[model samples]
Target chain A: MSDSDAQNLREVRAIIARHKLGDLIFLVTGLLVLMIAVLTFIALFSHMLIDGLPRLSWDFFTSFPSRRPGSAGILSAWVGTTLVMIVTAAAAVPLGVGAGIYLEEYAPKNILTEIIEINVTNLAGVPSIIYGLLALSLFVHQLGFGQSILSAGLALALLILPIVIVATREAIRAIPVTIREGAYALGATKWQTVSDHLLPYSAAGILTGIIIGLARAIGETAPIITIGALTFIAFLPPSPFKEEFPYISFEWLMAPFTVMPIQMFNWVSRPEEAFQVNAAAAGLVLVIMTLTMNALAIYLRYRMRKNLKW
Target chain B: MQFPVTARRSDNTPDSSTLGYNYRRHLSERFIEAMLFLTAFVSVAITLAIVVMLVTESLSFFKHVSLWEFLTDTQWTPLFDNAHYGILPLVSGTVVSSAVALLVAIPMGTITAIYLSEFAPFTVREMAKPFLELLGGVPTVVYGYFALLFVTPLLQKIFPELPGFSLLSAGLVMGIMIIPYVSSMAEDAMRAVPMHLREGSYAMGATRFQTAVRVVMPGAFSGIAAAYILGISRAVGETMVVAIAAGMQPNLTWNPMEPAATITAYIVQVSLGDLPHGSIGYQTIFAAGLTLLLITLVFNIIGHLLRKRFREVY
Candidate 1:
C-alpha cells in the first residue's frame, strides 16, 4: 500500500474511535441517572424507617392522636384507611370485574365495544385530580354526600375501576377456551360455564389484581382530597354504610373519615416541625401498608402462574 | 291406516314441554347478557361524565376571559387584585421542566434498558429489573418531599444562586421519577427486535457497541419515542413534585436557577382554598386544567398511534 493511503486509513480509524467514545459517554451518563434515582428511593425509605422505628411501638399502632407528637398514634388514620379500602373494594370489585367479564366474554366486537375499550384505556391515564373534581361536582354538590367516606370511596373506586377491569380481563383471557367448550358440551349454559369454571380458574389472578388495585387506590390522594376527605378526623368512622338505622343499611356510609395519604399530606403541608415528623411517620405507615399489599399480589400471582394448567 | 288415531297424533306432534324449557332458558340467557352490557355501558358513562364536566366548566371560564388573553398573557395572578389571566408563564415552566426531565430520562433509561437487555447476565438482569420498577412504585408525594428536602439542598451547594425551590431540583427529581417508565418501555421494544438483525451485524464483523448503536437502537427508535412522549405526559400532569419543589412563582424566565410554577402546580395552589362559585379565579383553575388535560390527551393519543403504527408484525 502507498504511504498516503495508509495515512488516510489511520484518519478514518481515528474518527471511528471518537464516535465510539461518544457512545460510551452517552451510556455512562444514562446509567448514572438511573443509579441516582434508585439511591434517592433507598435514602428516603431508610431515613423514614430509621427515624420512625423508635417511635413505632404497639401504642403507635393502637392509640389515637394526642396533643403531643410522641403521643399521637395513627389508629384513627389506620381505621379510616381500612374503612376506605373496604368501601372502595366493595363498590369497585363487582362493577369492575363484571365489566371485565362482559367485555371479554359477552360483548360483541362492535363500534360501541371499541369505544368502551378506548375510553377505559384513556381513563386509566386521566390525571387523578380530574377524578377528584368529578367526585366533587357529582357527589359533594349534586348528590349531597357532603365530604363523606362513601363519596371518597366511590370516587376512588371509579379511579381504580379501569385498572381493575384491565387486569381482570387479562386474567380471564388467560383461561383456555377448551374449558368453556367442555362445559358447553356438557349442556351447561353460558353463565353456568363462566361461573363454575372460568371464574374459579381465574380467581387467584383476579384477587391479585384486586389487591394491587387496592394498593393504588389507597395511595391516591387527589380524588379523595377533591371529594373533601377530612384532613384530620378526631373520630373513627362509625360504619362502612351511610345509614344509622336499619342496622345493615346504606345510611352509615355518609360519615366523614381521613385516609393515610391525606393525613400525610395535611401534616406535611403544615409549617410546624412536629407536623413534619408526624408526616414522615405517617408516610412510613402508608409505605408499609402499600408494600404489604404489593407483596401479597406478587405472591398470589406467582401461585396462580404455577398452578395454571394449559 | 290401521294405526290408532291418538298414537299417530302423539308421534307427529313436537314435545311442547321441552320447547317451553328451551324458551325459558333463552330468556334467562338474554337477561344475563343485558346485565353484562350494562357493565360496559357504565365504563362509557364515566368517561362521558369527565369530558362533559370539564367542557362545561371551561366554557363558563371562557365566557369571562377571552382565549387570547388566557393564552398570551405573561402574568398569571388570578387570585390577587387586578389579576392578569395569561397562561404563558405556567406553560413555559411546564414545558421547560418536562423538557429537562426528558433530556435526563431518555438517555439514561434507554442505556439502562440496553445494558440490561443486551449486556447484563440473566441473574444481574433479573435483580435489576425489579429494582428499577421499585422506583416507579414509590408515591409521587414522597418524591416531592425528597426533592424539596434533599435534592434542592444538594443543588444549592453547586449553584449557590439557586432558590430554595428552583426548577433545577424539581426537573432533576422529575427526571428521576420518569426513568423507570422510559427504561421499561424501551427494554420491551429492544427485546422485540428480531435477533436475526443483530446476528447479521455480528457476521459483518461489527463490534457489540456498533451493533447496538446502529442496528438495535434504530430498530427500537419508534418504541423509544413512544416512551419519551408518555414520559412527557407524566411530567406535564405531575402535581405533587412540582407543587412542592418548584416554587409557585409564575415567572417567564428560562434560567433553571429561579423559581417557576407549572399548570398542575397552579391548579393545586388554587384548589387549596375556598374560591366562590362563578369567580374568574375559580374558573381559571378549570381553564388551566382544561389546557393540561388537552395537552396530555394529545400526547397520549399520539404515543398510542405511533406505537400502533410501528409495531412489528412478528
Candidate 2:
C-alpha cells in the first residue's frame, strides 16, 4: 500500500476509537448527573424530615403562632389556606371547565377564537407575582375587597384558571371528532353530546389537570404575598355560621388570612435557630401536601391512558 | 337520496308537542352556549385588565420619575430620601443571576433529557420523570429557604468569603428548580424527531451518541431553543429565592457572588412593607412590575414564534 493510503486508514481508525471513547463518557456522565440530582432531592427531603421531626407534635399543628418557637403552630395558616382554597376552587373550576368546553367544542375557526387561545396560553406563563399586582389593583383595591381571604382566593383563582382551562381543552381535544359526529347522527344536540359523552370521557383528564393546578396554587406564595396576605395572622376568620338572622355569615370573606407557605417564609426569615426548625417542619408539611396532589394526578393520568380504548 | 327525517318522531308524539320540545331545547342550548362564551371571554377580559392595570399605574410612576432618568440611572435607591430612579441595578442583578441559572440549567437539563430519551429504559424513564416533576413543583418559597439556609452556607465554605446572601446560591437553586421544565419540553421535542433519521445515521456507521448529538439535537434545536428561552423567562421573573438569598441590596454589579435585587425581588420587597396605593413607593414597584412584564413578554413571544416555526417542518 502507498504511504498516504496507510496514513488515511490509520486516521479513520483513530477517529472511530475517539468516538467510541466519547460515547462511553457521554453515557456514564448522563446517567451520573441525573442520579446525583435525584439523590440530592431525596437527601433534601430526608434533611427536612430529620431536622423537623423533633419539632412535630399535636401542639405544633393546633396552636396559633407565638413568640416562642415551641408553642407556635400552623393552625391559623392551615385553616386560612383551606378557606382560601375553598373560594379559589369555587370560582376557578366551573369557569375554567366552561371555557375549555367552549374553546374545544364550540369555538368557530375565526380570529376571535385564536385570540382567546393565545390569551390563555400567555396568561398561563405570566409570572405568578404579576397576578399579584393585577389582584392588588383590580380586586383588592378597585373592587374594595380589602386585604382578605376573598381577595387572596380570587387572585389564586385567576392565576390557576389558565392552567385549568388549558388542561381541560387538551382533554376535550383528544376525543375523536368521529365520536362527536356519531352523537350528532343520533340527533343529540351539541350541548347534549358535550354534557353526556364528551364530558364523561374527558372527566378524568380534566380533573387531574385541575388537581395539578390546585397543587401549584397551594405552593404559591408570591401572588398571595403580593395581595398582602397577613404574614402573621393571629386569629382565624370569624365562623361562617352566625347566631342571628340569615344564619350564615360572609364576614370571613373580609378577614385577613395566612397560608402555609407564607408562614414558612416568615419562619425561615427569622434569625432564631428554633424558628429555622419550625420552618423545616412546615416545609415538610407543605411538601407532603403538594406531593400527594401530584401523585394523585399521575395515577389518574396513568389509569386514564390504560383504560381508555382510544 | 333523501335521508329519513327525525320529524318522523311525530308518529309517536304529536307534531305540535315535538315542535315545542325542539324549541325549548333550542332555547336551552342558546342559553348554555352564551354562558360558555362568556366563560371563555373571561380570559380575554383578564388579559385586558392586566394590561390596563400595569399601564395606568406605570403612568403615575412616570409622572414622578422622568422616563429618561428612570431608564438611564445606575442606582435604584427609591426608598431613600435621595431617590435615584435608575433601573440598572435591578436589571443587572436580574441579568447576572438569570445568566448563571441558564448556564447551569441548560446543560444539566438537556443532558437529563438526552439520557431519558436516548438511553434509559421505559421503566427508568417513567420513574425519573415524576421525581423531576416533583422537584419542579416544590414551592419556590421552600427553595428560597433551601438557598438561604443551605446553599449559601455551602458556597461560603467553598469560597470562604462568600456573603451570607449572594446571587450564586439563588441562581444555582433556580437552576435546580427549572431543570424539569427544560428537560421535559426538550425531551418531547427530541422524541418527535422521526425514527428513520436515527436509523439512517446508524446505517451510515454513526454511533448512537453521534446520531443523538449531531442529528437529533439539531433537528430539535428550535424546540430546545424555545424551551431554553421559556426557562430563561421563568428564571428572570423568579422572586422568592433571589429575595431571600440574592441579597436585598440593588447593586449594579456583574458578579454573581455579590448580592443583587431583581425586578421581582424589588417588587416583593416593596409589597412586603405597607406601601400605600398611588404613593411613589407603590408606583415604583408598579413600574418595576411593568419592566418585568415587558421582559417576559418579549421572551414568551419569541419562544412562541419559534415553536410555531418548528411545527411547520413536519
Instruction: Output the number of the TM-score-best candidate.
Output: 2
Clashing pairs in 2: none
Alpha-carbon runs more than 4 Å astray in model 1: A1-34, A62-70, A240-252, B1-15, B277-279
**Tens digits of lDDT, candidate 2, A1-310:** 9999999999999999998988888889889979878876876688788888888889889989989988999999999989899899999999999999999888888999999998998887789889999999998899999899999999999999998998899999899988887888888888888999999999999999899988998999989888888788788899998898999998899998999999998898888989999999999999899989999898999888899887
Docking class of 1: acceptable
What TM-score against the true chain A does chain A of each candidate get?
Answer: 0.87, 0.94
Model 2: residues >4 Å from true position, as ranges? A1-14, A242-247, B1-14, B308-312
Candidate 1 C-alpha error for residue B114, in Å: 1.8
Clashes of 1: 11
**Model 2: residue B72 alpha-carbon error in angstroms:** 1.2
**DockQ for the candidates, in order:** 0.37, 0.64
Task: For residues B77-121, write the lDDT of model 1, one tens digit per residue.
Answer: 988888888999999889888877788887777778887767666
Measured over the true interface residues after superposition, the C-alpha RMSD of each candidate is 5.8, 2.0
For residues B151-198, what per-residue lDDT tens digits would candidate 2 score against the true structure?
888888899989888999899989988888999999988998999889
- By summed lDDT, which 10 consecutive residues of candidate 2 chain B come out lowest? B1-10
Computed on alpha carbons, the lDDT of every model, listed in order, comes to 0.79, 0.89
